[model samples]
Target chain A: MISRHGTPEHLPVRPFVALVALAVSVATFLWAGTAFAQASAAWPRVSPITIVINQSPWFGGFSKVVEAYEKETGNKVTLDVNPFAGSGEKQRNSVRSKEGQFDILVMNSAWLAEFYHGGFLTPLNTIDPAFKLDPQVMSYDDTGYWDAARKSNNAKTGVVYGVPINGNIQVLYYRADLYEKAGLKVPQTWEELAANAKALNSPPNVYGMVQRGARSASDISYDWMPYLHSHNGAIFKDEKAGDFTVTINSPEARQALDVYVNLAKTVGPPNPGSYGQAQVIQALLTGKAAHATPVIAAWPQLDDATKSAVVGKVNVAVLPHGPGGRTTPTLGHFIGGIPNNIPKDRQVAALAFLRWFQSYDAQVKYAQTGQPPIRSDVYAAAFMKTPEYRWSPAVLASLPNAKMMYTVPEGPQIASVLELRLNQAVLGEKTTADALNTAAAEIHDLMQKAGYKTARLPPLK
Target chain B: MRGTADRASAKAADRWRFYTLAPALAVYLLLALLPIVNLATMSVHDIHWQQGAARWTLVGMKHYAELPRDVLVRAGLANTALFALIAVTAEMLIGFALALFVSRIAVGRVLYRTIFLLPILLPGIVIGAIWKLMYNPDFGVINQLLHLLGLPGFDWLGSGSLAFLSVIIVDVWHWTPFVFLLLLAGLETLPQDIHEAAMLDGASAWQELRDVTIPMMVPILVMTLAFRLIVSFKVFDEVYLLTGGGPGTATEVLSFTIYRRFFTEDRMGYGSAISVIALFLLTLVIVLFMGMARRRMHAH
Candidate 1:
């Protein structure tokens, strides 16, 4: 039907349809332009990168640092926090999945070998040739490198695979008030520490000492590593030298075991074999024990008035030395790395985050958040001089002398054996010599089966 | 002609029955048999992840051969067997007694049933955590009670000798209610005419229970025992949260070992091999129990 003002009504409708088409074309052009602009602006990444980390004392601080990173870079990051054991499983699953789940893997020192040996990680140097690990951060006994040709972890020649995130190391936690009352100077050797334990010896009311002798996958063995390493004993003859000899049953190790067992049996809690990290910390905070060697990360609870009965009474010191040996704390640092399975863009984004994380400012923020800073400069920060940060000095002093348990991928599997046997020894189920010998034998069989040239020490006669 | 038509109708009914079952059977096969087949395939191969892809290296019978020598596997087998035997027996006996006591009650029966079933209502993980705190030597209620009595406190789950027993106690406490509920249902469904007949014959209550009621309840008892035994064999949460196969593998069970191998050790091939064996053993148990049940029912 024709309209009165126009030649035809459909002629007026033609312009309306044209207007609609023109608007849609303009909208499509604008949308495409904005998307292209975003693609250009969001260089290297548009999707969020995920970091898999275990829940630990430093997790809060680490999460804060991650938030700082996100704010600074405008890059999205998903912090996939899991329980300690669950994190490892998550990392393994992520790396093994068809498309990896995590961009960054926060690996425990114990499991670093598995990641490194399995080629599951992307070497940082390969990502950026000029990206050098900050020298101020603790090297964790050169755990960041893997000598692919030598099949060993060595900082001097191996490729850089990870950066230290949490500077975790064992430190001697002691009741300073008890020491003052007993008129005892700080112990310089394991022997002296033991003597002091004997002096402060009391049961039920207060144990002379409490040790983490529980047999989780690696708890007891981890607690005993300080003793073992300080005693000039090693799980291998020389892991750095590519020597795969099973030396856990060496005479030095036997003596170390003897000391560990004696302290656990005589001075520790009644159920020391069941005392994991939590139990040890509880014993210290409640003033039920006078001494312990928990990770420095646990130092925050010592002075927390809300949790501690003996606040301001505890002090930190380097783990005592063995005869003819220097103080050696066990390195329990958590290192962060990119898995090889992720997309190149994600890998780049992860590397960028790590690079920013290692900056001096980030380290300072990390320290401010009550996390153990990995950098030496952060350890010497003004805030560390306060009474609350009293443990920082000892942690700094101990980290340089810290040693990783093993540099082999078999570290965890082998640690399982030691954890069980050492726990048995602590519980008086096996003699120290018998336990060490059995551990060495089992480790030898394991390494050999894994196609390593390994041999155990002769049985302790 | 009429007989032939009836025969043809029966054959058509059989065809209809087959058609009715086909879809369900296909779905069951797809869900169940595929995983079993995949597990079998994995057991014969050494699997390694390379750039997020599983690289399968054929190593036929290697993992299976290593199973016998694996100390953890052996310990797991022994502990699992021991745990099933003791825990199941305790649950069955205690459950039977509770069922008998509740069935005879004329008042507050529903309340007693609810109270008895409370343990099973709690999640296994929650139960494990609660029991762990209760067993703690320092501040736990068990030791605190002992201390109040001026007696020495004992480390219940810490000692190698006591850890396994402590776990068993937790299992028995948690699952007894399950058995009780089942047995009570069985008791409720038992015909009352037999009990009345026995009473009219001047048989005592105990005699009626032993000779008339128990004999009638044997099939149900056997079925309940088998179910409890199967569940007990799969115990992991209690062991995981409480002892974690600690105090020198005292409480290590098959499921925990498989968990360690798969998750902790990342030995998928070996873990699958262990799983295959466990599945086979469990299936055998199920088959044997069903056979026994059928035979007992036939005898009755």
Candidate 2:
């Protein structure tokens, strides 16, 4: 098609440009195809398989175990790790939206109800019996799984939905140096704790105590649940009736809020409403406060040089008693479950990986890293015998009595209301009674809107 | 014969020009007009999310009936109107002054013009984030400067009243440049002979400006005001990131309210209703503005 020399030269350039464009397009298409093929291949295969963990400590120890398992079995094992923070709700929501994205989800027990109800997770009972009996397999402790946590994991039809991965119970953290300076012992009751807090108040440099006052799902709800339970407050009465009728408007709940708000006002910093889990930890770590009630999972941060200022001076104990005369810690734990959409072969591989991770050896390794083990035997193992972790066993022993947050479909919404009302009371915008009454009314209205029946009061025992 | 055919065709075209506009009208109806009609229909319904299913039922003007009684909704509407009035007025005044100054400049005029348009070039989100850091209570430059001046630091985004002002300030900073650029272009294209003639007659600068320049700039000014009003009415990003509609819903604008209903509350029907009401209100305001401009133009 060449005519003039100039036109011929121009024609070559055009073809060259076209050739480059075609090559680029082909390369891109092949690249995309290969990526898709690689992604599909990464999906769990039937034989000895791979399990991806999107959690913390479990991924740490489980990764090594998976490698060993594959080496011994002569089958390839792949594990992917995803770390998250704050509440685990976002992670749970992710799995619910994208099934098969995770072969096994490492999630908090609090989310089990939502997961099971939404059909996002598979029940462990359906796994192959051989892998189910694998002692190395991580499974929920039949005895150690407390009533609240168990009830949370129980499907409406009474089927177990998840295997407990680790246990977490709330504890009171205090600075021993400050307690000594104030000539106070560890507070045993809420009244005593308040007294100690007031005594330890030193002004702009330091405060007596700090807790999570921030308005968020986890920050406000975590510490409040124990207080509600200690004072015998019930979020709801009848599950079948869907009655989310009663709230923390009872005398006990009010007393708890009153005590909590009063202490937060007098001893808390200028902006108590902005404080959350990390801030509470910072209060104790930087010696800004003498005490805080945080989950046991955060205790490890106290010893990390980068995070804590009072490494050796910090100590942990069960939460103080309320009017009930019994200390009740809130139980929080992570559990593992297979996705129902995962291929059957991959499910077997996930079960195999879980069995190894839950073995006594692996659990002990996890305990040594400062996470509480779910197994009864692991609590008395070599890890707990160490001086650094001697108190962890005591914390673990208290897990049996710990209470979980309410697990109804409306649980999150009710918790949001409580958080908002509690924040108002703490900020002195409303009295404890006033806040509770308003919250109770709002919660009752929400329950009615959800079509739940009103619960009748039970006769006294 | 061809010339006669062409003349006849041209005459017939004049009679059927309306048909030529039909496709555009059809597209607008399908995309914009129809969705608005659908939104108005959906607004009066209750909707909830259960097991990934959205259930909706007609509640009739119940949401609207409740609107007057809902204190937060009322406060939000009042705040939005107040924000639009104050913020748009300030932006227009400041923008006009900048455009006038830059238009009179000689040396480095192009450079100054580019610099004047720089704020408009940056994204809204970036502007909001930069302003948020500036207003931070603890280590922000604003507080640091206040401390340097031996004055007590103030919570810019933390205080309810100040948070609203802070968002307005950021809006003016980002969007005034847009108005300035528009006005500057209008200023450049204005007829100079009228101003020169007035100056020759010993007319005072204020008199000449009030009587000549401003009158000529009417159409451009109206266009700028209309554009800014529409944008300011949908203020979302800055307020959302800055205050999150909080320190107790002080900065909760209508857009933020609609977003919360749609995403957080999962009440799509209620959200759709709010959107419909907002759309209707916006349309009414625009029409009123156009009428006023038309009247002013006719009077001139």
Candidate 3:
């Protein structure tokens, strides 16, 4: 309604233009604020990632983490859970055949070398994916990590492939009431363990010990590791030697096998040679067994009144000492990694998920949910205050001495080779020494054929 | 010219039929034969994903040569033979009796047949799980029943040869129905004249069973026994679920052995070699049995 030169009905064109500019300025400011808020809430929605996991507590715990990450980052996580039997092999077969279904894969630490060398795993360091671990959501405390755990995933070239998630260590689970009634001490040596077991055992009612003696790559091998390690036997003499020669044939190994075979014959479950951890666990839970060497991670289930019959009646102690004068349990851990086939963005997203998952809060929740913790700090004074986590002290005690299984490119194959022979010894089909020697020879042949630097070391002096 | 036209039209019709069937035939070849050819090829090559991307190298018959010396393979073969012998024998005898008994019944024959068929209709996994529960040494109903009878309980799946026998029991329970159904069909198809003549001759039930039923059911019996052997040799799911070829490989069979080699050990080439060998063994058994069956038919 304005005319130029101050006419009566004219308004100033500059004022109209200024009014329009003012409205535009206010609207722009409001839009900018909303956009900033939205950006912070969800920066980039990642393409969906597929994951494979066994039905371990870690898998269950990670499902919760997946839900949390989805809300936080606007990314969808697809979980493919495998059953307890042969899940490891299925994952490997599918991924190696380029099924293109998975973005992330989780496997045992024993399998790290096999997967890494096979190019199925991406080196986490190249992407430094752990950097995506949010400090607020995840514990960044260096002290929280166990010895070498933080850096254990690093390859020889200093590339990191796997991120440690959950770990396992073995402890002696004993019937405390039975021990008290029998007037026995917690056995410290293998000789004492056998004697105590034999003393407490009565046929057809109660047995001295229950153990997994089934001839499987995972089942009985894990049960045997503690004895093997406690006897100072190892699968390899010097991994650094490059030839990676196995040392399971030493006298120490034979001694361990002898103890195992004797236990099955004298005080173990009636058919211990045919059963695995499930049977052993069943025996212990039902009060049929007075002693067992169950993984500490699984002990919480034994303490829960809802799941176990021997709640509060069972107690944990260090594993009985072998000839080496100390107790040792075989080391096992489930580790997570981005598959090498994943594009960089998906790998980064997987890293983000892991970083948060391995955070302190998540590990605490993991422990709360009956999984053994991978962190050192979880057992520190403040965390173990909860009464439900009855085996934390024993787990902490066992962690320092846990010996990881042979981790090599040929690890899975080596395990099968060793398990078959070990079981043969258990069944009295072969003498302990004979089984060890045969197994060692076969493994040596396998390594030599695989073209590793081939040198068989003499017995450790 | 008219005859040539007619021939041309008939040829066109035949070609059309083949074209219509081509897609299905192609799919069948792809699904069945390709993997077999690939497995044979792989058996001769050292192909494993142990180093990640399956490293393929031609290794000849190394895996086959290793089979005899391989302890697991030998154990698997022994166990499979024992399983086939025990399980097939039990099922055949029991199934034959049940068929004869049911056929003699004048009432509720359909109901009895359905009840007998129930176990086979259930999935193998379900049967395995149910039996595993029943075999549990501690609280399983089987042990409880033993206790009620004031007899000592046995560790059904936990000890020595018991594990093998336990798996056989499961196989029997699941597959006896199949034998019964087949033999019952054979029994029904038999001419009533033969049985009538036996009855008219004042033959007792035992005599009739021995002379008439036994001789008449020979073809079906042979087929059933031979088929059961092949299925029993390939016993995997039941054993895998129940005992996992355990109690120190007491129940290990050829299929389970192949699975262990192929998957657990990551030795695809070795496993393929074992499979090829098993294929040949099974083929030989089938061919020999078929030839024997033909001979027996001719004799009849």
Candidate 4:
């Protein structure tokens, strides 16, 4: 009977042990928490940010800026610079898939609208109001960004989703020596340009002109947009409208396509339909093509010791006007945006790095390395006045007049259809009207398949 | 005495079973079966890189339905099949000819075998890059040679048809040695008495090869062909490093298409759908080949 009574005492003893264990655990956890808080407070907040950039000279320059930023801000940044070959669509899909691999991305203006609308990117508006109000830290000036870049930043969700990293506009490059030899002045109109191209072409050796004809997003659209805009054929009904209607079959657009086909067939290289950006640049640099419409970013390659043959002789100018009496070069600027996957500390660090990288001083530093800066003041700086960039001021001046390419949710698919038609047209497999109609049909089908409503454009007056 | 013998027989059987089956079964489960099972599971799930989670909801037949509409996918599948058929056939014929030629050689047989096997020792990517440079339109050795010969230089990779043929040529150059090595081993191991008897019976060299030698070598030939078929169907590195499925989807294979959909398009579910389809096709081919091989072995 006494042993049974002692069991109750043992039970109380076990409860006491349990309580003691719990108290120790709580004390240890609190101590560790305080220690961690102190350690973290002492350490400079290091955020791991990943920046995805399209391959170009500008990206090369940006890498140096990133290095400087990491050194100054105590942030860890992983720079992923993918080459231009398949990167446009790859980046788009990655963002759409919500691959949090990127904290910041340098994307072309054409992708801005799609990425913004798809909720792939975070709005700057959602950022801390304090960060938005800091004039020195964050300034959203319409003039600071080029006109086309500003328009592209107008997200369908009515929030700014991108900031222009650098200017990437198309400009006409011609061999001054060849133009002089042919007694041709710089062409002011598409007709004059075609005539000059014909006059300068020497078959099987020297091509008159070249542009990207490869079947990818950038390759097809970069070469085609200037023609479309010059003919006054808009991709959508209006910039503000969210409708996806394509006016590719408009008379002006067909005429533009016809002109393009004629140029590629008669004056362009024999295999213009298969040429890519590299080939097109090579043709101009190797003196095989008298003229080409290349992204201004490629202009620096003309002076590369290992690649260029016509270093001093090549000149850059705005693309020739078409029937509309205006030449709207397509904007291919890379925009910087923050990824939302990262923690708050990392986001702040990344934003700091971005702010420092886009500063006036950093922009000038980039200009010295052959990348044209996004800021207008950077162009007027002394560094850009050097002999290496004697033509940069004029190139910079052309950005405001530039127009953004068509931005659609299914931009790549639409680009692919157009690429196929352009190839067929260049190969003389189909007439301009036939190719445009087919392309329009394919684009319509693709949009519908992607769950976008079929858009009907208002008839042209 | 009967009990003792029964115990001894059981021990021997256990030892034999352990020695023969354990290592192979372990390897199959670890290296092959596990991955195959994992891939099969991944095929049904949508995966992407987002916030923190990488995979999304189950998208069963969505990707399969989209396959027919994808022009690149169709082209890639067709190209892969064509490449497999052409490369396998060419490699077998060329490899067999070299094996027969080397087997007859009285001098430098070892040297010839060593040299013939050199390309197989080289890495696929290295071979691909070397061939890419050679096929370059401007300043490439091929065009330079053609220019010297007073022939117009052709765009090897620029043209779709030519690019497909160019990749096959490179593959043949690299893998014909693999076939040759297998065939040589079979030829060298053959009983000398049969050839001697055929020759004594007044059988011509052609007749001996076609009747005695080829009939004996059928097992090895079938084995090599099956192995090469599977390898050629999964041709990814060479084509990827060389053309990157370009000059506009001209040389894209099914594997490359799947990779693009998975990594480039970020349509992991769609990519897995293609992978499942590829897996099924490959398994069917393997089973059919194995069945044929079993029949051939039984006949022998």
Candidate topping lDDT: 1
Query: lDDT scores for all predictions?
Result: 0.87, 0.69, 0.76, 0.73
Model 4, span B163-274: residue lDDT tens: 7888899999999999999999999999999999999999999999998999899989999999999999999988776766665567879998887666544455667788
iRMSD in angstroms, per model = 1.9, 4.3, 2.8, 4.7
Question: After superposing candidate 4, which stretches have Cα over 4 Å from the reference?
Answer: A1-55, A67-103, A108-128, A132-152, A155-161, A234-240, A401-406, A456-461, B1-66, B106-111, B121-125, B241-252, B260-262, B293-300
Q: What is candidate 1's TM-score for chain A?
A: 0.88
Error of 2 at B63 (Å): 5.3
Q: Is candidate 2 or 3 superior in DockQ? A: 3
Candidate 2's C-alpha runs over 4 A off are: A1-114, A127-157, A164-170, A216-223, A237-243, A276-286, A294-301, A307-313, A328-398, A455-461, B1-75, B107-133, B173-220, B269-271, B287-300
Using lDDT as the yardstick, the better of models 2 and 4 is 4
Assess every candidate by TM-score. 0.91, 0.75, 0.86, 0.81
- Which candidate ranks first by DockQ, i.e. highest? 3
Model 1: fraction of the reference interface contacts it also forms: 0.55
lDDT of 1 by residue, B1-300 (tens): 999999999999999999999999999999999999999999999887544466799999999999998878999999998899999999999999999999999999999999999999999879988999999988999999999999998899998889999999999999999999999999999999989999999999899989998989998898899888788889899999999898888989999999988778778888999999999988898898789888877887
Number of the predicted model whose TM-score against the real structure is largest: 1
List TM-score (chain A only) for every prediction: 0.88, 0.77, 0.80, 0.80
RMSD for all candidates, in order, please: 8.3, 11.2, 8.9, 14.0
Task: Rate residue B128 of model 3 by lDDT.
Answer: 82
Q: By lDDT, rank the candidates, best first.
A: 1, 3, 4, 2
Model 1: CA > 4 A from native: A1-47, B1-7, B49-55
Instruction: Please state the error at residue A38 of candidate 2 in Å.
Output: 25
